[model samples]
Target: MSDSSTAAEQTYRVVRNDEEQFSIWWAGRALPDGWYPEGTEGSRDECLARIAEVWTDMRPLSLRRRMEEATAG
Candidate 1:
């Protein structure tokens, strides 16, 4: 196998937090507390791209909820 092919085959997983933030995690590693898989697995670049597409809101979930409550009240 070539070096490029090996690099391309490098595995990654997409994980999300309670705030809905997205991150790429190395495959074959245990997920940290408070993070869960987003059901995506691929190359590192691919996982990052998937995160970019889905994680549009940068705000944490609690902050967003507070903002919404304030606006509503």
Candidate 2:
């Protein structure tokens, strides 16, 4: 109902897992296992913007590596 509360609700952080997938997580909450912060924190839109900018490759890291290996051989 207040601007401050609304802003607080919008706060988020960018997180990534071992697979290198990008996602937004609520700030101040415990990150799930294997998920670590990607160091960008701000409103939901800001976090998502960062993800869009950096996560151009949608493939998971392991999958990409395997695909490269298969091609190289």
Candidate 3:
């Protein structure tokens, strides 16, 4: 296979953080400081679909926490 095709075929995985944010990460690369793998590794499209299905709420964890605190206080 050609070098360009090989590069284009890189794999990815779905990742999420404490704030409930989602992102796609390269399959073999080290995850960043706060992010961790949320689901199986696959093509970028597959990971994005998984995030869309589960990440129904768009707010980050901090925002959700503040909203809850305001409502309670």
Candidate 4:
């Protein structure tokens, strides 16, 4: 989808196996549309990497303090 906040309905929920491995998906929620890796399944690293990339691309946090402290006196 568009580069915007992650809505519950548009985020790709990473479901991990009992052993904490990337197993299943709860897509269309934790991510926007068309955000995924090609032929990358059962790969924890890849899944997390994609998640981080997507989250960062969305500016997940609003750290105003960190954003202005250096410039603010």
Candidate 5:
């Protein structure tokens, strides 16, 4: 309802899971299980930019490993 509240809502932190999947979570909130902070925090756009820069591999870690194994055999 207020400008400050809206700004707060827009703040986010980049996070990643065990599968190496990248996402954004609200700053100062409890992260979900299996997700850990990547030490970058900012507005939604900033967090997304960080994810874009780091998450070049869209595939999950397990999926990539499986693909590698399939090709190796």
Candidate 6:
């Protein structure tokens, strides 16, 4: 369960088009809603970090609760 659940909770990624249009995907599935960065003026790493921050903000409470349960289990 740990191994498989960890696999399921792995990081998701955002892919952008040449036009800056993009979509979100998680665990091989497309996220229902699309997303785009709202700020500018940074290095590539900074941009990626911002994306990560957004991802964390959108993380599911179900995942967090499951992780806590896994740890407690």
How much RMSD separates candidate 1 from the native structure? 2.3
Alpha-carbon deviation at 9 in model 1, angstroms = 3.5
> What is candidate 2's lDDT per residue for 1-73, written digit by digit as tens?
9988787677799999999999999899999999999999999889999999999999999999999999999
For all candidates in order, the CA lDDT equals 0.91, 0.94, 0.88, 0.42, 0.94, 0.51
Give the alpha carbon lDDT tens digit for every residue of 1-73 in model 1. 9999987888999999998888988888999999999999999898989989998989999999999999999
Model 4, C-alpha of 36: deviation from truth (Å): 13
lDDT of 4 by residue, 1-73 (tens): 6434333234334543322223336454353343443333334455567555544433223454456766887
TM-score (C-alpha) between model 2 and the true structure: 0.87
Candidate 1 vs candidate 2: which has greater TM-score?
2
TM-score of candidate 1 on Cα atoms, chains taken together: 0.85
User: How good is model 4 by TM-score?
Assistant: 0.24
Q: Candidate 3: TM-score? A: 0.82
**Could you tell me every candidate's TM-score relative to the true structure?**
0.85, 0.87, 0.82, 0.24, 0.85, 0.27
Off by over 4 Å in 4: 1-40, 57-73
Residue pairs in steric clash, candidate 2? none
Give the poorly placed runs of model 3, Cα more than 4 Å off: 1-8
Deviation in Å, model 1, residue 67 alpha carbon: 0.4
**To one decimal, what is the Cα RMSD in angstroms of model 3 from the true structure?**
2.2
- Candidate 6 global CA lDDT score: 0.51
lDDT of 3 at 25: 92
Better of 4 and 5 by lDDT: 5
RMSD of every candidate to native, in Å, equals: 2.3, 2.5, 2.2, 13.9, 2.3, 14.9
Alpha carbon deviation, residue 21, candidate 2 (Å): 0.1
